[model samples]
Target: MGSTEDTTSTTYSDASSSPTQPLLSNPAPTYPYPYPDPPPASEPEPTQFLQISYNYGPRPIKDLPFLLLFSLFALSTFAFGIFSSVNRNPNSSSVSSFSYDSTTASCVKNATTSSTLRSPTFLPLPNSFALHSSSSSLLKSLIWTLVITLIISVPFAFSVLVLLKHYTKQIVYVSLPFFVIVPIFVNVYWFVACTVSSTCDEKFPLAYRILVLVFVFVIIGVIVWIFVVNWHRIELTVRIIGVAADALSRNLGLFGVLPALTLGLFVYFVPIVVFLVLARLNGKIVAREEDGEYYCVWKQDSWVPAYYALAIITMFWSATAMVEAQAYVISGTIARWYFSKDGSSLKRSLRSSLRNAFGPSSGTICLSGLLICVVRFVRAVVDNAREDAPGMVNLILRCCVNALLAAIDFLNKFTINFAAITGEAYCTSAKMTYELLRRNLLSAVFVETVSTRILAGIILVLSAIYAIVVCVILKAASNLGVDSYFIAVMAWVLLIVVLGYFVHVLDNVIDTVYVCYAIDKDKGEVYKQDVHEVYVHLPISRNSRSASALVARTPLVV
Candidate 1:
């Protein structure tokens, strides 16, 4: 009995001694002051996305290939079989390596890791179990069959079950937006709804989508019905709703209050929230190790909290949009069709009008952005098209193209302001920064916004022109004619595109005083104060050295 008790004690001790993951309970490691939790938050509370207290620890199952290969050696231990995680099936191809040619020459197609999402597939998976497949292809195939079969039958089971239960009918309404907000969690439920859910699936397979849409039509209809029935009763409601929407969205901003547009807005804001959370969590942002030394700059940022707050704003706004948009679509139709309730025969005709509104209303926000892209697309094509060499039409087209270019530049600036704040720069990196600063410091002059834009554009155009012009001039000299003129223009056009982009990069680097400032502070961040950094002396101006001029002139493509 004493030996048995001792064995039990050892086992318990061993289990308890294992390291467990720590929770991010809103306190820093350096500050050992115990975390005083905030008061409970409720509706109208500042929005916050809570993280689950548990992490799956690190990926201990690295080099899955070896384990898979080992499974083939089951002859050694007579254990050659499949290894599967719970909720996952074991399959043959599941052990096989999967690879594909990628978009940007990366391991994953884009040569980029998922910056925000945990999954390679951004859309949440409801039914990917085991995280591994079966060793037997036939077995894997059978599992898929069962999965599909289950998906097909479950929906009907649910709809019929719910229809029979009176209490379940109202529950559907309350449960909808909850699913809307975190559909990722109850993915299996939605997946079931998608398949064999109901005959209503024929009309609207997504019962939630139909219910929401119907609800929208109903709400809008009631508002219209009230307005028409009284003929003049609630001037305040109409004015408040209409004016407030327009006022809040005077800037080219998203409107979250209305149902006509909301889902896309939710998608748009998700990245913003994700970025903030990641920045707070990222090892790079929190601290850095260099030359056997470590540095931290976490609490130095004041806007850290604002990131979370803004994400909350994005979520609440999205939820509001889903609710309000649903109300409009559901109620508007009823008002238009059934408002009078007394021989409103023409009210049936109102369906045509409502249909027109509802047609594009479902994705109006997405549609608006799409339209902008279309406009940008057209502008890109037209600008690249040949122009009359010397005519008013040419001038007009040029002006229009220039205006479009200007608008795009402005829009990009606005986008940056609205987007999650980023601390990194793309393109030439520190080299570009050094060059621009060298030019600036040497010239002892700053680039005016217009000159900056034009100067960069000129360098790129000149470089590209040089390359294309050299090529075209050779062609023209060999067969000089009207073709010569065309060749010259071609040189000029290609020249503009490449050189223009080069200068654009150069100009952009100079403008980012903030980034340069950060770099100067790098000793305090990335590198240790002790280790010498390789610094390049750069020429920063128009009248600069060969390195920068080559940067613009060497462009084969923008």
Candidate 2:
């Protein structure tokens, strides 16, 4: 039976068939041994495999034209500022008419007599106490203080990195508890002291006491709320930090690159500072009378204010660009390290990342940088308005502007990270990032709140301690008088900048890891198993069945 069936089918298949009909129609029933039917003759099987070629370089230069135009404008404005400064004559009456002799003499007499410069008979002095004392000594003290701060902060930054790497969880736990307890202890101590000391009762009136109590309660509530909400995710945050530290430690070359970028920024600012100082020389000195005294004031040229505005805007843009550039470099480097199969490519990754940051992706950085600068500038404007005119309207405007600034900052964070990884344009990267994060059930706000608060707390504590240490050392070593306060303030600022950069690098690392993890989850692939194992605990949206399933699987550990 099988032989006869096969012979009949073969004979029919061999016969000339109509072009419209397939000869193998219903071929499955032809043999006793069931045979599978062939595919319809109209649809041909694909013979050519789709090839995906990866291009290593020459990425489409995003926002290049805008970048170039802005650069040209910046350079022209800088030149104009320089020319205005150089052409102004210091010996001109307008420039030299304002005499400081009387003020200087009064200050000197007050200093020698050990009396306050604010004697009723004396003209009002500048707000800075340094101005009332020996300005030269104050300047010297500030310079020395900053120098000392830099020396100390470098080592401190390294120590922090080491601590973060080895004892992230311990630090978080200890610091958070201390942070909570210290405030409570201080508030209690204050209340007790106020109750016991009659002087405190007189100094802190009922209204003041009530205000302080309210402020304390509000702050404590906020702290407690943050702590409670993020408690479960603390471990995940630590793991993220640990992974960042590990990646950074492996690619130590980033450390070198960061400082170089900073130095470059400093170098770039030199001319800006010079231009700012010289730009002031562009105005005409006009004679003016105040308090029955005639003094020649330099009235700036009409264009000077506009020029100043331009310079200021340029500075903001440049500063933001430098910061964003650093983020890009860190993100690119860390993302590369995260995806690479081995440590052999560490140096190569850093180099390539650097090239991409400053090369093709630079325009994207500039675009984002400009946006942040504009937002910040507007916020500053609104803040000034609020300060000058404190009203509900100004306050509300300020609040709205602040919220906008924060939103931009939040969006820029991950957008730049995605752009760093894929070399996408700013808008495109932002869209893709939003979709990727949304699809993966990630909350930008939650991650930001948890990670930022923790890191900010660490930096604040370190900076405060550093400031106190510097103050103590200054008090022991020098008789700076009121200048000591100025020095300490400057020292604090320096430490914040130094430590802030350290934190900034780690922050970028965290953002990069977040984006990389999101990519992995979206594609249903694990690029870094250890990270995947830890991140599996990250909270996903309850509605996401696919994400739930993905999380349910046991992470494959190498």
Q: What TM-score, over all chains together, does every model reach?
A: 0.19, 0.71
Worst lDDT run of 10 residues, candidate 2, spans: 18-27
- Give lDDT per model, in order: 0.34, 0.71
**Candidate 2, residues 233-253: lDDT per residue as tens digits?**
888887777777776777677
lDDT of 2 at 421: 83
lDDT by residue (1-558, candidate 1, tens digit) is 555545544444433322231111121212111235634544532322122111112212222332343233222212111111111222222212222233432121123444565656575366544333323433443344334434433343233223323332233333323323332323444455555556647666566765665665566556445435633322322222122122122211111222124455566555555454453442212334558654433332344355445445434434433432333332232222221234435433324323422332323322223334445556767666644265778778878876877654443322221110111111112233333234344322222242242243223333333444444544644533333444444544544543343333233323222222223333233221211121121223354344434433331211
- Candidate 1 clash figure, as a count: 39
Q: What is the lDDT of candidate 2?
A: 0.71
CA lDDT for candidate 1: 0.34
Off by over 4 Å in 2: 1-55, 90-148, 185-203, 210-214, 283-300, 384-404, 463-494, 542-558
